[model samples]
Target: MSPLNSALFKNTTNDNIVHPDYFVISGFAGIPQTKYYYVFLCFVYALTIIGNTFVMFMIYIDHCLHSPKYIVVFNLALSDLCGSTALVPLVIDTFLFKSHLMSFHACLTSMFFVLGFITVQSFSLAALSYDRCVAICFPLRFNDIVTNKSMSFIIAILWIIAALAFLVAVIYINKLSFCRSNVINSYFCDHGPLHLLACNDNTPSTVMNWACQVVIFWLPVIFIVSSYICITRALLKIAAASERLKAMKTCTSHLILVAVFYLPLCVSFALGGALHMNARIINMSLASVMPQMLNPFIYSLKTDEFRESIKKLYRRKKMHITGRNT
Candidate 1:
């Protein structure tokens, strides 16, 4: 459709208008031996999907984990599985299959999911922090405040709010005119590069973008930090050394998760927007997905209940195999 003819686009002339067939995603275009990068992406997808699935499965089958805490972790694993699945396959295709021919609507859809997952992750992490805060700060009141029914209600509201923010974001972008270039510069359809491609006056969308960022990014960081501080204070007040250590132990996995997700993202976005940092931005963008790979291991290695459940599952499997042979 012509940019001028379309109702969605603002005022535009023929000089800044060309509705190309599709956008070319030239990922790693300047680099040699592109097939090697494709191979590595394959490894990333394989590990991410498999490990996250195992985490979900273990939580499901283990009766010991039928509590609010495990349920929250289960949702995070689900988000990781879905978020990686949504972006990575198409990313591999764009790298290997000469993916310079994706439709405009397809590009928007990919961008939506990529950002949508980040939105889900933001809410998920905040929910996890809130749960931890209640448990650690109010031991006696934890049962009343953090029950399974209440947790479900809170998660529902968090998801609804996040969904609305991303929906508004996509609608805002869709209203703009894109006549700048049909070539996107990232591995996938990130919102930043796509926003840069718009030829229209993008002040509205830019403001909305920042609004969404404040809700989905900065708010979660503030809440997570505040929750951890209270948790730390609570841990310090324990009368015995062993009790304090035990209290701290329960929080270790969550703190690791917060660091794994937030730190890389903050650094990547901060430096990615800096002047003369093209190489650093691309490397950091690649690094952002590393958290999905690390999350399963972090929970499995550090969380006692999950670790014990997995061991019990393994012993059962081994005994079953031996029995069958006998």
Candidate 2:
């Protein structure tokens, strides 16, 4: 064992399991002038919270919006809200407040919630794509195919799957002996960074890392792409040019959302080895948070129903204020 591993193993319990008291988060290390970056993260978090909340509130109050499609939208908004909550504030506390020391259990808990919500967010986008696919491809049978109850069931299953998967990953981390460095090199207590700190066999965790990539990233992306292809084929079948445009219009928001969320990630993954550590971290961080901040705005502006709902709500609030003044 190296000197660092020897020092870590000195804290071993009677059961021969090494558990460090706390981990030093080194994500922002070697970066200069990060205060401005922290401020920007704060701004992004605030926008994500406000925008997602507004979308959810609009869907809740409008009976017309309480359909299968809106159910998927509402699920996306909720996941964005919760995912940002899980990640940003803790990030602010860790970096901005300079509280980089996280306890072992605390680190695991953070890992679970952050990764769990991210998993849900990824699958939620896939669910939204499925909604669009059904709506566009089978317009006549859209209601029969996708209902409120069914959408709710799908969302529930996604949550359960994400929770269980991350929970198992965390359990695996708990079992590992951290006899190496206690410093995690990611912006958060990420699975790869945490598992790499283990001095014992980490093959399981390594396998889980690839498994998570398949579940959280690749699978959802593939599903969304396939759904859009089906939607395109359906649109091409429409004889009238006007009808084709109308059908294609509805998918614009979803397409933009997919691009916004996935493109940055794709770029980062493609250039991973070429970029410096700080640059890679910055790119990944932006990719994660920017999508949540942008989703609500995209849906609000692009979806006719959501935009109308917002207008109705605004008029109602304006009239109420005028009445009070009178």
Highest-TM-score candidate? 2
Off by over 4 Å in 2: 1-14
lDDT of 1: 0.78
Off by over 4 Å in 1: 1-20, 272-277, 322-326
lDDT of 2 by residue, 174-265 (tens): 87888768888889989987899887888998999889888899999999999989988988889999999988888899889889988887
| lDDT at position 152, candidate 1 | 78
lDDT of 1 by residue, 1-326 (tens): 55643533333344544344467776577667868867877787888888899999998999898788887888888888788888778877776877656776788788777777777777788888998899889999998999888887877787787778777877777776675566677777666666777777778788877887788789999999899899989888888999888888888898888888887677766765563444653564565466777889999999999989999999999999999999
lDDT of each: 0.78, 0.88
TM-score of each: 0.89, 0.95
Query: Measured by TM-score, how close is model 1 to the native structure?
Result: 0.89
